[model samples]
Every structure is written in C-alpha cells, then in structure tokens.
Target chain A: MTTLMAWRNLRQDPIRFAATVIGIVFAVVLISLQTGMLLGFMKTSAGLVENAGADVWIMARGTSNVDQSGLLNESAYYRALTVDGVESVARVVIQFSGWKRPDGGMESVILVGFDPRTGMAAPWNIVEGSRDALLAPNAVMVDRLYADKLGVSKLGDRVEIVERMAVIAGFTSGVRTFTQSPYVFTSYNNALRYTNVEHGGASYMLVKAKPGVEPAALAERLGAVLTKEEVLTTSDFASRTRQYWILTTGAGSALIMGAALGGLVGVIIVAQTLYSATVERLAEYATLTAIGAGTGYLNRIVLTQSLIAGGIGFTVAAVIASVLAASSASSPAAVLLPPLAIATIGILTLALCAIASLLAIRKLYTIDPTSVFR
Target chain B: MIQTPESLIVEDAVLTYGKGEFATPALRGVSLTAKPGEVLLIRGPSGSGKTTLLQLMGAMKEPDKGKVSICGTPTTGLSQKRLRAMRLNRIGFVFQFFNLLSSLRAWENIAAPLDIIGMDRGAAEKRAKALLAEFGLADRADHFPKQLSGGQRQRLAVARAIAHDPPVILADEPTAALDTENGQAVAQILRDLAVKEGRIVVLVSHDHRLEPMVDREITIEDGRVVEERGPARPKSNALRSTLSALIEARRAASGDGRGGSGARQEGPRISSLS
Candidate 1:
C-alpha cells in the first residue's frame, strides 16, 4: 500500500519526477565512476606482485618496490632452496637503465632478469611472441601498451640498454607498470650485460613453495636463514607495494576524495529531490492524516518513494559504469568495477536514499490533521 | 437489516491557540449530543468555532478542557496515535475543499481509509468500486480527482469518507462549492445514510436550505450555542425539495447566484424566518 501511494504520488507530476530521477542517476554515476577509477589506481599500484607466479619474494634489505630493489648476494637464492618447504628459487635482477632508441630518444626502463629454469617472476600477458624468444641473443620483451613510450616500432627493433644494444624479442599486452618506467624482460645472462650489479650478486630471489606447502611457512623459514634480505609472502609484498605508492606517496588519496565528494553530491541531490516532492504534496499528506493515516504510514510511503527512485538510478548507473569499465580493458588506466565494488556501491546508494528521505519524513511529522478543516 | 451508530457526545469543550499575550480562544465550553440515526446541523457565522467544534468531535483536536467521547470512550488525554486510530475505525470526514488525494484515482481515494484499517486490498478495492457506483461515479473510478468536476470531486470525497463503514460521519460545508442540484443531491445522500443505515450524521454549514434535510438545527455564535431546534422530522421529502428550490430561486433573484454557478457566495447569508 505504501508503494502504491508512493508510485501514484510520483506519477502525479511526470516532469518533476523525471527530473528527480535524473538527479539521482547523475549522483550514482558520479560515485561509481570515481570509485571505479580509485580501484583501478590501487590495482595498478600492486600489479607486479599480483601478477608474479612466485609464492614468496626475497628482496634486498629495505626494498619497498619490486622495480626498485638494491643488489643482494646471489648466495641467498641457494640458501632459500635448502628450506624444507622451498620447491625452487629463481634468481632475479631489476635495475633502472637508460634505453637509447634508434630514433635518438632516451627513456628509462627497468631491466628485469629472471632464471628461465625456475620460470618465476617473468613477463606475462604475451601478445606477440613466445617467452622463449627472450633467450635469443640480445633479446628482450616489452609491453605493447608502452611501445610508443619506450620508442620501439616493432619486433626486431634495436634499442640500447645502458649503452648496450638489444633486439625487441616480443610484445606483451596489458602488462602496465605504475612506476612510469617500462619493463625490459630477458634472461639472467642478458640482463647482467645491461646492469651494474656486482658479479655473483642478484637484486632479488623469487621463491616457489612446494606442492601442499604454505608460502607463509616457506617465508618464515627463509627469513630465519637469510638475515641480510627481507622475505615476504606474495600477498604481503602486494600490500606493501600498494601501501608504498597509495598511502605513503598519496597517489590514490585524490581518487578516494573524489569518490567521497561524489557521494556527498549524491546525498544532496537525492535529499533535495525527495524533499521538494514531499513539499509539492503536503496538501495530499494532510488529507491522508484527515482520513486517518498514522505518521508511520506517511513515513513508509516517503521511504518507499526514495527507494524506488534510487533503485532505478543505481541500475542505470551500474550498467553505464560496467560498460565503461569493460571498454577500458586495453588502456593503461584500467577502470575496475569488480563484484565487491558493485556491491559496495549498491549499499551506499540505498543508504543515501534512506538518509535523503529523512527530510521528507520530518515534514510529514509536522502535518496537522486539523489543517484540512481550514 | 438494521444498522446503528456509536453515539457521539461533546461536553463543555474548550480550546485556545497561541501562548501568553497572543492566546485566542477558538472553542468555549460548547456541549452537544448526537444520537444514532440523527442528521444534526450546526449553523453559525464565520469564526463562530463551529469548525473547531467539528474537529474536536472528529478527534482531530483535543480540547484544552472538557471531554469528547464516542460510544462512551472518552477521547481527552488520549495519545495522538490512539486518536488517529479512533478516527480511522469510527469517524469519517467530508471537507469544504473536497480534500481528495489528487494523485490517486477515484477508487483509490475512496479505498484509502479502508487501507488504513488493514483491510485486504482486493476486498477494499471492491468495496470502493461499489461505493463509487452508488455515488454515480462508477465511470470516474479510474480518473484522478483533478480530472473530475467539482460536484464529482465532492461526491468522491463523501464516498471516501464512508468507505470504511465508520459509524459517525462529520461533514463541514460539503456542498458549499457545488450547484444547488449537487448540494441537494449530497444532502439527500447524507440524509439517506443516516435514515437507512442508522449512522450519526453531523454537518456544519452556513447555507439555510440544508436545514430541511437535517433532523435538528443548532445555531452558534461567539463560541456558544445561541439557539437549538427540536429533534423533529419537521419537513417531508417533498417539502425539503420545495424548500431547496425556493432558496435557489431567492438566490437567483438577489443576484447572489453568481451567473448560475450554483455555488453559494462566501460570507454570511441572511436566511428567511419561514
């Protein structure tokens, strides 16, 4: 009955009702878009650790980012392999090197070297060539998304890494880096030729746990033996990397603030819309009172109206946001509207609508049944 | 097939609005009794507290002093919620403005009080349809109140009030905005409701022609009853019809008819002593 009355009241003025619905839709879209962008920002900040197949990473002491590690003694890799739960450990090196393109442009690139035997912490999402292509002489792999930025035209293009020339062996898709520097993937022997790491020293070790073994246990065991380096499980590494860029550097706070502002705007729009709608029908409400409707009944009708408007607005906004999210799949700035994100937006929208109805309900509580006699 | 109303009683009720130096008394110790199957009329000049008294009887307002009761249940000091429930289950109202909910269709408007009583919606709607047909508004069931004529809207208001089968019907100038024909038609319906259904019908009006239809007439002035008529069926149906025509003729001759609009002009109208 409340819904029936609410719907009828809404339908009384089609233009006003439509305007209210549009206002709500505008607010909802703003929130979803801002939140989606924030999620995209956070996901990109931790991309390296999330995409790594290794269960644990042993980085140089005080290494905050996977792409910015200091040199570590290569002997840590052998010590990690002796751990009871350790299956295989891959020797890895990462170093910032200047790349001189044939077009006479220079760009910084992170030269990533991983042992092909352990097959851990390597470039993924390959679109143009096999991972084995990196084994060729002077071979290296880069993401297609960064091809223009890295000054590469095609496979077989020659570029100088740290004054040493290398051939573009493959192109990977969607391997976007958050550090602005592009990743150059190659074999450990090839990487050593391009970086200044000391002989018999690697930047990091990627440790894989054995089947049925937990990565946390493996990390603890390696942590006890390798006192000079820090051992972190995959999830911990990802969290640390995200916190470093997002929280400490304030890279993601701007997006969070934007989402919050969108929410506030949505609340104002919805509250104003519902409030005006309630005002427009104050006489009708007074009539309801005269006809014996209690205050509770009046409140139910208003909340039901708000929910209806919000439900429609959220549906339209979610569909629009999802389509936008899917369309950004190939872009470096991905829009991630995951299931959890969608659910959160749903709860937030409904709660805002409930809050917005408060103003209208306050007006209803002031209605005097005797006013009809006047 | 006899029906009876829960008799209504108001004893020395007093009410005042505002505070301190601004206080103005609205109703002053007005007492009245309306028995089952009686059509009682309250006539008074503007601001005579007739409307305020009617509001008290409907449980819309609590008097600052004195007591109002329906079927011996005193309404003083009752919670607002309880007062509203009593109104929903026992009292019906007809307003001068025909305050029908404009958004709802005629049937929905009529079914509103029934819905408040927690009736099955389907059954409530069926009863509303039947009442609409009885009011000659069957074809207007799906039309919103704004889409109806003034007379039709007033009829809809009356139908809505009585839809829940309340024992008491209180109307304030129900026919003030209608033509003489509509006014007479509405009065006839209220008269039939009281006589045939044995419900208590009380109305406050300034128009004198409605007198023929009521069983008793109480004229009030300055918040007090100046005069009271007998509880007598003084006029026959034919006489009531004739009296309605005479009043319409008198208004037409006096130029108060307002170009055949049939609505009585606002303000005090002098009634013939006959």
Candidate 2:
C-alpha cells in the first residue's frame, strides 16, 4: 500500500520526478566513467606480470616495482634453475629505449626482450604475426593500440629502436603501459643489440615451477640461493606493480579521488531534489501523520521512490559506459566496464539515493501533524 | 452498522507554545467530554485555541499540565507508536482545507485509512465506493482532488474520514471550504453520523451557522470555554434532503448539476435552515 502511494505521489508531479531521476542518472554516469578509467589504467600497470606465463619473477635486489629493476648478471638465470622445483628459467630484458618513428619522430618505448623459443614474458595476445616471427634478426612487436602512435603499420615495416634498425615482427593486442610508453617485444639477442647492452646482462628473469610444484615454495627456495636478487611469486609481483603506480606516482590516488568527487556530486544532486520533493508534499505527509501513519510507513514510501530512481538511472549510465568502453578499444586510454564494475556502480547508486533520502526523512520527523489544519 | 464510540475526556487541559518569555498559551485549563450518539461543536475566533483543544482531544498533541483519554486509555504519556496505532484504528479526521492527498483519486483517498489498517485492497475499494455513493458522489469517485469542486472535495474528505468506520470522528471545519448550502448539507451529514449512526462527532469551527445542527456547542475565548449549549432537537431527514435538493437545484441551474464548477458560488440559502 505504501508502495502504491509512493508511485502515485511521484506521478502527481511528473516534471519534478523526472528532475530527480535525471540527477540520479548524472551521478551514475560520472561515477562509472571515472571508476572505469581507473580500472583500465590499473590493468595496464600490471599488464606484464598478469600476462607472463612464469610462476615467479626474479629482479635486482632493492627493486621496488616491475618497472624500476636494475640489470642483473646472466648468472641469476642459471642459479634459479638449480633450485628444487624449478622447471625452466628464462632470462628477460626489460629496458627503456628511444625509438625513431617511421617519420623520424622520437618516442620512448619499453623493449621487452624474451626467449622466442620459450615465449615467457612475451605478448600473450598477438593480433598479427606469430611468436616465431620474433626469431628473425632485428624483429620486434608493438601493441595495436600504439601502432599508429609509434608510426608502425605492418609486420614487415621497419623502425629504429635505440638508433638501431628493427622490423615490426608482430602486433600485440591490449598491451598498454601505465608509464606512457608502448611495449616493443623482441628476442633477447636483438634487444641486447638494440639497447647496446653487454651479453649476459638481463633486467629480470622469468621462473616457471615444475609441474605439480608450488610456485611459492619454489620462489622461497630461489630466494635463499639468490641472495643478490629478489624472487617474487607472480601474484606478489602484480600487486607490487599496481601499488607502485597507484600509491607512489599519485596517479592511483588522483583517479580514486575523481571517482569519489563524482559520487559526492551525485549524492548532493539527488539529496537536494528528493528533499525538495518532500518539502512540496509536506502537507500531505502531515495529513497522513495526523491520521496515525507511523515512521516505518512513511519510510517505505520515500525509499521506494528512491529505489525506482536508482533502477532507471543505473540502466542509463551502464549503457553510456558500455558505449564509451567500445569506442575506446583501440585507444591508449582504454575504458573498462567489467561485470563487477557494473554491479558495483548499481549498488552504489542505490546507496547514494538511500543516503539522500535521509535528508527528507529528517524533515519528516519534525513535521507537526497539527499543521495540516492550517 | 456503526459501532458506538467510547467517551473522550479532557481534564483541565493546559497547553502553551514556545518557552519562557516567548511563551504564548494556546489552551488554558479547558475540560470537555463527548459521549456516543452526540455531535459536539466547538466555536471560537482564530487563536482562541479551539483548534488546539481539538488537536489535544484527537491525541495529535499532549497538554502541558493535564490529561486526555480515549476509550479509557491515557494518551499524554503514550509512546508515539502507540498513539499512532490508537489513532489509526479508532479516530478519523476531516481538515478545514479538505486535506485529501492530491495524488489520489476520490476513491483512493477514501480508501487510505482502510489501507493504513491493513484492510484488503478489494474490500477497502468496495467500502470506499459505497461511502462515495452515500455522499451522492458516485460519479466522481475516480476523479482526483483538483478535478473536483470545492464542495465535492469537502464531501470526499468527509467520506475518507469515516472510511475505516472509526468510532470517533474529528472534523476541523469540515464545511469551512464550502458555500453555505454545501456547508449545511455537510453539517446535516455529520448530524446523521452522530444521531443516526451512533458515532461521536467532534467539530471545530468559527462558523456559528453550525449551531442548530449539533447536539452541543462549546464556545472558547482566549483559550477558555466561555459558554456551552447543547441537546438540540435532531432535524428530520426530510429537512436534510430539502437542503441537499436546494444545492442540487442550484448546481443544475448553474450548469450540469455536477458540482464540478457550479457549486463554488452557491453559498447557504433559506432552504438550508431546518
């Protein structure tokens, strides 16, 4: 019965009801967009660790994150292989190198050099060409999102990395970087040549646990033997990388704050609209109160109205977020609206409206039922 | 059939608004009671606390230094929840402005009190329809409050007040918004509700025109009862019918006899007098 009354009350003033719904929709869209962008960027920050097929990562001692590792002697690779439960250790070279675009424009790129035979720490999603293509001399790969930005188009196209000639051997899909650089995949030997580094010098080593062996146990074993380097399980490495960008560089904090501000604006708008609606109908409410309607009955009416607004607003915002995500698929700034993100936004919208309804409820509590006589 | 109303009692009620230097007394040491099968009318100018006394009797507020009871239950110290329950199940109200929920149609508005009592929707609807028909508003049952004439809206408010068959009916100037003829017709209905149906009707108004129709009249001045008059002869239904017919004739002469637009200007006439 209270629900029916709420429905009727909202219909009484269609324009005002619509204004309230629009306020809710605005909140939903802003929060979803800001949060979606943050998730997309966070994914990029942990791209390499998440995609790497290795069970553990070995980096230089005192390395705070995946992107800030020092070069280790090639001996760390063989030393990791000697640990019990260690299957095959692959040496990887991750370095920042200058790249000359096809038009001679200079851009910084992360040269990820891996063993083409093992494919460890290599691009997991290849949109063009195959892994074997990296076996070719001076062969390298670039993410499709940055292919146009880096001035590379086809697999056979040649570009300059570190002032050394390199061919675009493959195109990786969705391999974006938080550091504002495109990852260029190449063979270990080619990477050494391009970066002009000495042989047997690697920035990191990818370690795979033997079948049926626990990666954590193997990581601990390698940690004991390799005192000069740090060994981390894949999960820990991903977390460390994400936290680095989110906490240290101020990027993560800024994105979270943006999302919070969007939510705050949405709350304020919904609160004001709902409060005004309540004020407009104060007399009617007072009449009800005089006739013996309890607080619970009145609460049901206001909350039902709020939930209706939330349900419609969520649908509108989700549709807009999905469209934005689809269009950004090929752009460096990806918009990610996953199922979890959609669900979170839906719940948040409901909560926001509920909180906004509290303001109206306060006014309800103070109403003198006798005022209806006036 | 209307159940008999339990006697409502107010004992030396004293009520004041504001505090200390800003204090303004609304009611002062007033006392009254209305038994079953009686129509009690309270008359006073604005600020004389006639309305305040009505509120106190209705359990809408508590007196500062007195006691009020309905059906033998003390209401001054009752919890809000309990007071609300007592009101919902026992009392009905008709406000001066005809405070019908604008969002609801006439039938829905009448069904509101029943709905609050958790009555089944179908039964409540049927009862509302019956009540609307009894008030000669059968055709306007589906109309919203704004779509009805001032008189029709007042009638609808009365219908809503009695929808749940509450034993005690509190009407604060139920006819204040209507013309004299419609006002008399409404007053006739209140008399019928009290004498014929055996329910207690307490009306608060400044309109002395209501004097002859009621069993008792209590006049208040400066928050105190100045005079009390009571036990008038109950007017016959034929006289009530004559007053109603006069309204209908005026309604018809003005236009469609529908009262939707024509009844506003048709104030009280000689035909309305018993």
Candidate 3:
C-alpha cells in the first residue's frame, strides 16, 4: 500500500512526473556519453601496449608511455633473446608519420612496424583481411574506424606514408588511438624503408618470457643484459601508458570534467524535482504521520518512487548511449558503450536517485502532524 | 494507582503555545473525559480552543500541566513513537477539511489506516468496500477526492477515521464543509459508532444542528468551559446565562483595561465535560 501511494503520488501530476524523469534521463545520458568517451580514449591510449601479445616491453631510457618512447638500438632484441627464460624477442618501430590520402590531403598516422610472422605488437583484431596480408610487398594495415580519414577503404587500395607508396593489405578494428590518429601497421623492413631509418633503430623490443616464467623476474634478469634500455612487464607498460594519457593530456581532463559535470547536473535535477514533489505533498505525508505511519513506511514510499524514476531514466539513457556509440563507431573519437559501462551507469543512476530521495525525505522529518489539522 | 475507565480522558490539561511574554496560552486549565458508548459534542467559537482539546484527546499533543490519557494510558510523557502507536490503535481523527489524500480513491482513502495497522491488503480492501457500501458510497469507491461531492468526501473521511475500529473517534467539524443532509448523515454515523459500536465518539463543532444527535453537549468560550448538558448531568440554562454574562463583563472590562486577556487566541484547545 505504501508503494502504491508512492506511485499514486507521482502519477497525480503527470507533467511533473515526466519532468522529473526527463531530468534524470538528461543526467544519465550526459554521464554515460561522457564516461563512454573517456573509456574509449583511455583504451586508445593503451591500445598497442595492452594488446602487444608479449610478456615484457623494452623501451629506451626515460620512456613514459608507448607513444612517447625514444628509439633503442635494434641490437637490444639480440641481448634479450640471449637471456635465461627469454622465449623470443621481436623488434618494433613506432613513429608519427604523414599519410598522403587519395585526395592529396595529408593527415597524421601512427606507423607501427612489427614482424608479421610473429604477430608481436600487431593489431589485435583484423576486420577486413588476415594478419598474413602484411607479408605482401609494401603492404600495411589500417584501422577501419580511421580508414576513411586515411582515404583507404578495401584491400588492394594503395596509400603513401612518409612519401613511400603502400598497399592496404588489411583493416584492423578498435585500434584507433587517443591521438585520434589511425594506426598503420607495416613490416619492420618496410617501416625502415619508408622512414629512411637505419636497420638498428628499433623503437622498442617486445620480449616474450618462457612458459611459466614470470615477466617481472624475466624483465629483471634482462635488465642486466640490456642496460641501455628500460625493461618493463607488459602490464606495467599498459598501466603507465593509460596513466600518462589520463594524467598528462588535456583530452583526459576534458572527458573527465564533462562526465563529472553531467553527474552533477543529474544529481541537482533529481534532488530539486524530488524535493519539490515532497514539499508539495508535505501535508499528505504529515497526514500519514499523524495517522501513525512510521518513518520507515514513509521512507520506503519515497525510495520506491525514486527507483521507479531511475529505472525508466536509465533505460532511456542506455538506449541513447548505445545509439551514440554505434553512430560514432567510424568517428575518430569513438563513443564506446561497453557492457560494463552500461551496467555501471545503471547502478550509478539508481544510487544517485536514492541519494536524491534522502534530500526529499529530510523534509518529511520536519513535518508537524498538527499541520494536517491546519 | 487507579485509572479512569473511560476510552478518552483529559484532567485539568493546560497547554500553552509560546513562552515568556510571547507565551500565549491556547488551552487554560481545560479538562474533558469520554467513556465508551458515548457521543460527546464540544461546541466553541472560532478561537475557543476546541481543536486543541481534540488534539490532546487523540494523543497528538501533550499538555504542559495535568494529564491526557488514552484508554487509561497517561500520554503526557510518552515518547512520540509510543504515542503514535497508541493513537494508531486507539484514536481515529476526522478533520474539518475531510483530509482524504487527494491522490487516492474514496475506498483507498478509507483503507489507508487499515494498511498502516498491517492488515492484509485484501482484507483491508474488503472492509473498505463494506464501509463504503454502508455509508451509501459504494458507487463512488473508485472516485478520487476531487470527483467526490463535499458530503461524500466528509463521509469518506469519517469512514477512514474509523476504519481501524479504534476505540476512540475524534471528529473535528466533520460536517462543517457538508450540506445539512450530508452533515446529518455523517453525524448519524458518528452517533451510531458511539451507540452501536460502543466506541467513544468526540465531535468538535460549532454547528448547533449536530447538538441534538450527541449524547452530551459541552460549550467553551475564551478557552474555558461555560456549560455541560448530557444524560449524566442535568441541563442548566442558568449556567449558560451566567457564562454569557461573564464573557460580556470581561469584554467590557478589556475595552477600558490596559491589556486584554488573550484568552480568545485562535488555536486548538482542550475542555472537559462535567
């Protein structure tokens, strides 16, 4: 009956009810979209390191993240291979280079050079062709999300990077990085050919530990052999990469601030609407109090009402966010509505509504039962 | 300690609203008692404090001095929670505005008290339906308060107040908003609840038409009881006349006096039927 009363009270004014729900929806949507974009950008920052498919990464000294690393002597690969518990080491080259589109427009792209046979530091997901496609002469792969921006669509399409012509051998998905730059994958030899760098000028060394060997321990041992480079576990590199982008970049700050603002707006709207609703019907609540209804009963009613509004608002926000994620899939800064994000936003919305309800319930405590008689 | 057997009792209750010089008094040394199977009518002018007396009897307020008891339980120092429980189980209130929740239907309004008392929903609804039928409002069971007429609303309020079958029923101007036909009908229900159901029914009203239906009539002016007439006590025209003369003399004196007795302050008051 108390629950019914809550529903009836909200239903008493449909315009107000809709307004409250719209307020919650606005908040939920804003929070979800901003958080989703943040997650997307964070994933982009850590993309190569997180999916490097190696136990450890060896970068030049003073390296903060994958994108900010200096080049190491390619011989560091042989040094890591000679260490105990070392499986196999692959040399990688990452450099920001200019891409010449078919329309003669120039755009910046991160050129990654790895051994296609070992698949180390390669794109994790290929949407168009197999990873083996990189074996073709002068071949490179581009992320599907950034393919249009790079002016390439399908296999056999040709583009030039650093003024060297290359064929689009495959298309990778979800490899778009926070630089909003497309990741173009090529073989180590071809990357060296395009960038005109010496063969020994590898940017990082991807080290795989022997089965059952701890990466940190292996990295520690390899540190002794390759004193010129910094050895880090794959997880450590990924964490540092994510942290660097989140803490040092204005992109991270903007996304975080947007999300926080959305949450604050949502909380204010829900608090104000629920508080006004409570105040409007304060006499009714006091009437219940005078009739011997306990505070628990009244609280449960308000909570039930808030939950109802939150449930509807969350559903609406999730739908809008999902649509946004789908529509922005091809955009440079993709909106990522992961399953976990959806679930988190749902929980957050409900918690916020519950908190907002408390602000309204506080008014109930001040209501004098004698006011009913008045 | 022996306790009064009455369902509702007020013994020399003195209630004041503010403090210091701002300490205006609403009820001054008033007393009231009602036993089971009796309908007591309390009549007072606008500021005579009749509502305060009813509030005290319902355990809704505590007296500054003396005592107000419900079902023989002294309520002066009872905790708010305990008082709420006592009121829930023992007292029913019908307000002047027919304070039915505006959002609820007539029957749902009647069933609210039952729900609060933890009655099963189906049982409460069944009882509410029966009461609506009894009050000739069965057809208006699903109508909201706005859709109901003034009389129907008052009748529904009375039904709601008594829905829990509480031993004490306090109706403050139950019929003030209703027409004569509906006012008499609601009055009859209050009377029947007292006479047939053996509950203590206390009606506070300025409507003289309801005086004849009650088992007793008590009048108050300036927060003081002026007269009481019932089967238990002899009717006295002399007492009424003397109280009226006293009120005139007090009014005349206040005109020439530096400060008037603020006895006519508007608020709820408690008075006794002797």
Kindly report the docking quality category of candidate 3.
acceptable
Mind giving the per-residue lDDT tens digits that candidate 2 earns over A1-374? 77787888777778877887777777777788778888887898888888879899999987777776798887887888789998888888888889999899999988888876678887778989988888889999899889888998897898888778999888989888888788889888888898755788788889888899998888899999999899999999999899888788898788788878877887787788778888988998899999888877788888887777778878887898788888888888877999999998899889888987899888888888888777
Question: Model 1 residue B81 lDDT?
Answer: 89
- What global local distance difference test value does model 2 have? 0.81
lDDT of 1 by residue, A178-232 (tens): 7778888998878888887766678878888899998898899899999888999
The deviation in Å at residue A139 for candidate 2 is 1.0
Rank by DockQ (best first): 2, 1, 3
**TM-score for each candidate, following the candidate numbering:** 0.91, 0.91, 0.90
DockQ of 1: 0.58
Each prediction's DockQ against the real complex: 0.58, 0.59, 0.48
lDDT against true structure, model 3: 0.80
CA shift at A358, candidate 3, in angstroms?
Answer: 2.4
Per-residue alpha-carbon lDDT of candidate 3 for residues B1-274, written as tens digits (9 for 90 to 100): 1233544778888888888999867788887678666788998887788878887887888999989877667898889999889878777889888878998888899999889989998999998887787777888899999998888888788878877767678888888888887778778878776655556789888898787788788888777788888854333677445434433433344442111222122221111110
True contacts kept of each: 0.79, 0.81, 0.57
| Most DockQ-accurate candidate | 2
Model 2 chain B is weakest, by summed lDDT over 10 consecutive residues, at: B265-274
Q: Model 2 has how many clashing residue pairs?
A: 2
Residue clash pairs of candidate 1: none
* C-alpha lDDT of residue A248 in model 1: 77
Cα lDDT tens digits, model 3, A1-374, are 88788889889889988998898888888888888888887787888988889899999898988876688876887778899998888888888888999889999888898866567988778888877778677899998878778898889987788778999989888677877667888888888887745797788889888899999999999998888789999989988888888878777788788877877887787788888988988888888888898888888888888988889989998998899888988777878888998998899899988988899989888878877775
